[model samples]
Target chain A: MTRQFLRHGWTAGLLAILALLFVFTKIIQPDFGTSGLDSLSRAMLPFAFATAAMAVVVIAGGIDLSVASMMAVAGVTAAVLMDGAGDGMTAVAVVIVLLVGLTMGAINGALIVITRVPDIVVTLAMLYVWEGVALLILNGPGGSATPWLRELIVGPFIVPWLPRSLVFLAVCLVAVWVPLKRSKLGLSIYAIGSNDLAAYRSGVSVGRTRIAAYAVCGLFAAIGGLTLTMSTGNGEPIPGPYLMASVAAVVLGGVVLGGGKGALLGPIIAVIILRLVRMDLTLLSVDPNVTTIVEGTIMVVVVMFGGVLAYRGRHK
Target chain B: MTSETTMFKSVGRFIGNNPLVPLLILLLVLVGVLEFMRPGIVNERWIGNTIKFAIPLAMLAACQTLTMLTGGIDLSAAVAATISAFVMATQVPIVGVPLAICIGLIPAIMIGMVNGFGVAVCRVHPLIMTLGTGLIATGCLQVYQRFVIASGSVIPDGLAWLGTGRTWGLPNALILFVPIAILIIWAQRRTGFGRLLYALGSNETASRISGVRSWQVFLALYMLSGLIAGVTGLLYVGLIKAPSLSLVNPLLLPSVAAAVIGGTSIFGGRGGYSGTILGALILTVLGTLLTLLQMPEGLRRILFGLIILTVTTTYIRLTEQSR
Candidate 1:
């Protein structure tokens, strides 16, 4: 029972802190009531999807540092394709955008499985290779996402109260979390993450499962990337920082780096909390530098705590 | 059995066992292709200058190989290099050039120590820990750049010569390469430290059980990696004669890639610096050839990605086949 409590405690703690931050920010900055919430949601919405994508891979016991790069590549691909489509092929280009995302994801998954390289190294390499590829494609093309597409991505959903991107975000959460409950593949992922050799003994195809997990991660990243393109309406050369931010979200969300243990919703909240951290810092007029320091301190401390947890768990 | 015949067998065995052979073959292949496309591409000037450009990267790859050998990756190597470059450039004018170079090693050693402590003593994973340090280093870069702005600083002309100046028709950068390569080779083949690294890489648990002090080895390896990155960064700054932060982007990929292709197992254990140097040379030549081919940067990148994917796959397949 106590173990379960500790398991849930990571997410609960972040939630509590998030609530405090939101409330405090609201109180201090009178302007934060509605617009702040909107900004908060706006800032977090795309990352929310990205975090979900990160969570799937993390839960499977691998890390995808390339999520940001995939997002960048996919986003740029979609934008450039849309731009080049010349109005007649806009719909076809959108389909192409999603397809390119899938292709990129497959590449990531394929490379990880075949090379058997550490996920970090493989993904870090992919992050560069893909981003370089994206930059080369864009090549200072200076394209923009369409107005309608931007509106669909940025505007409110049917409720007219929540962001439109929140709809896709909802679909993403359901798509992942639902299957996680229903599918043996999901359980096997958790098993593989916990102990791959043991999982292999238990009749799971570790390589296939891992590849699938990375593909799903790629898919999520691509989706996130396309959404971000629609929201921002531009392609970017530098996508690593934002990608690292998502990585920070995954780690902060209590997904253990070596894999096999973490909740889905935790990363979502982590993304929000991280965005809020930035928002709160901005609200309080704290130096953004302090935020970096705080973030680094938090990552090092959390990773240490995770080590402690794993150490104690092992001994126990 | 005759000693000469026995020696021949050992020499053949070493060639067969060494990772450098494959990388050398790759380099030869690259030269062949470049020559095929444009004859005399491997002329004395081209070869010497290529080696000069290749040295800083090769040094960095050697450091990366050592860290990766111990089952850790040093993402901060580039940042370390960048910081060192910035520091060297900034300090050389204030202090004497030689003194500036020596002082610059301090930051690299310190960053390395921090990485070592965090991973060894703190028990933090190298990735997260170095990432934090990497970020801190990046911030320091920004801070130092701001300092440069405030102080109106510039790297000294004499120090800049370390990058550009040549000796006996050979670039000074190439001079830095030989000693570093010798030291890396010595560390790997002629030392207890190399054995400890191999043992740690092969089996950390057994190595620890056998009293190898795996953590200490890790600490030392990380420190070495950092120190090497620092020197590499200095060389880079000297070469460019300015601290270009963008260099980190290209450096990170190729450094890690060179180590991998040079036949260093990314999983750690079972590789050498000789292969890393050869790998760096091959990759540098490949990139240069791509430019020479007049390929658009985009096509070149796509091709580079394909090459990486192909190389890693081939490396894995070859190992599997051997097993």
Candidate 2:
């Protein structure tokens, strides 16, 4: 039990920090109740999903610079279709947008494999490509989502205490992450990430695992996009800011950037903490620019701290 | 096979071994296409304009090329450039142009040194380290803008002339690029430090074992990257005739893309400024062509993305095949 606790100490520490921030926000704003929590969840869902998407890719020893762009593409596609096809076709529109995200991810994966190029290079290029596609789909961010879709995504849950966004996140955790993390494919991803040549020698399918990781990442990115569309009721062609936010969340979550280590829980907690910190700052009437500075500082500090920990552990 | 077939095979081999061949071919093709699109794109005025626009990017790409050669990257490069430009613009009023320009380099140099310390001494990944510093720089700039620097400060006339003025039928920026290019090429080929950089980049452990101080090399390279970014920012202010926060934001990714397209492997080692120069030119030409076609911004971005993808993939495949 102690070994297990120590093993996940970083994640535990993050959870504690999140709890502290939550309490701090509530203390600062006494009116911050269920309604405030609901809005916070709604605002955080996209970034939480994005962090998860990035975590998966990073764990697979690749980084996807296009995740935010994928979100934009998916959001724009859904928004345009929802606006044009009406509420009756919401399901079909979502399916198509999800397919778009998957296709984009597959293209990234295929290009990385076929060209033998670095993941960063391939994804960076795709980031621009998808952003362009998003802009092409919605030139100025005017498309709207159907009310039904919005309710389905961002509405309160059937149970009064739970928000739909939280429910959705829980579902994702239970349905996708829990199962995938214990699966053969997941193990293969870890193996390949830690050392691709060794994994290949040991009969793991490095290429396929990498592609699958990216596909999963894309699926989550699409979810993030849908959530953004639902919450905002519109599509934003420029989703560049979310890219850094997602990365920051991943780092804060205790995920190793070099690959082969990390859990989904860290990023989820990190996301909430990040949002709560913003909420706290807003309640305190801090400057908006300070938010970016704080976020960046946290990212650096967490990464540096992690580096030190890893170094000490190795040497010790 | 006949002798003719053998000759063809050898020629194919030659092209395969040399990464620059395809880049040159691509450049020629782009030039031809641009000329076709606009009947007089081949003329001096247009070409000069293209090179003029490319100069900043070329310099930025050179900065990227240096760090990339050392297996590191500077995501904050554009921000670093912006900070320097902001400093120069704000300080020129108080300190005059020459001293302000010299003072402007301080922030860039300091930031680069900090990035070097983090990466070389602390062993943080370059991406995260530079990103953190970049955020700090940007935040500081925001604070500076909000509190200190008044808006609407014009660039000094001397610097503006160097930026826009031509000498002996060449754009001054281009003229400046000549010495910068020559210096980099010469340093890379002739200096002991240059050899150490390649050695450290190619195999850090081996180099460490063989008496190369990897940290020193990393420090120097990162510092050089910062200095170049500072110089690029100064020139950029001249070119744009003002310093804005977002002045060099768009160039960040393009600079990295240019370095990659120029055959600088992002992983480290095995690339040069010469290739980056060509890459910058090609990108400038592409941008010019896109504008001449009056393509919408969305389509233009999509085209640029596609070009980066296609060119990079082709180059990677060619190199893999040759190997």
Each prediction's RMSD over C-alphas, in Å, is 3.2, 2.5
* Alpha-carbon runs more than 4 Å astray in model 2: A84-87, A153-161, B1-18, B149-152, B321-323
Q: Per-residue alpha-carbon lDDT of model 2 for A1-316, expressed as tens digits? A: 9999987998999988988888888789988877888888888989998999899999988999999999998988888888866665988998898888778888888878877889999899888888888888888887888887777656578876678889888797668888898899999988887899999999998888888889889988998898889889988889847787888788788778878888899998999998988888878998877876787777777777777777788879
Give the C-alpha miss distance for residue A271 in model 1, angstroms: 2.0
Q: Candidate 2: give the TM-score of chain A.
A: 0.95
> Scored by CA lDDT, what does every candidate get?
0.76, 0.85
Report per-candidate DockQ: 0.48, 0.61
Best-fitting candidate, scored by TM-score = 2
Say which candidate scores most in DockQ: 2
Interface RMSD, one decimal, each candidate: 2.6, 1.4
| CA lDDT, candidate 1, residue B178 | 82
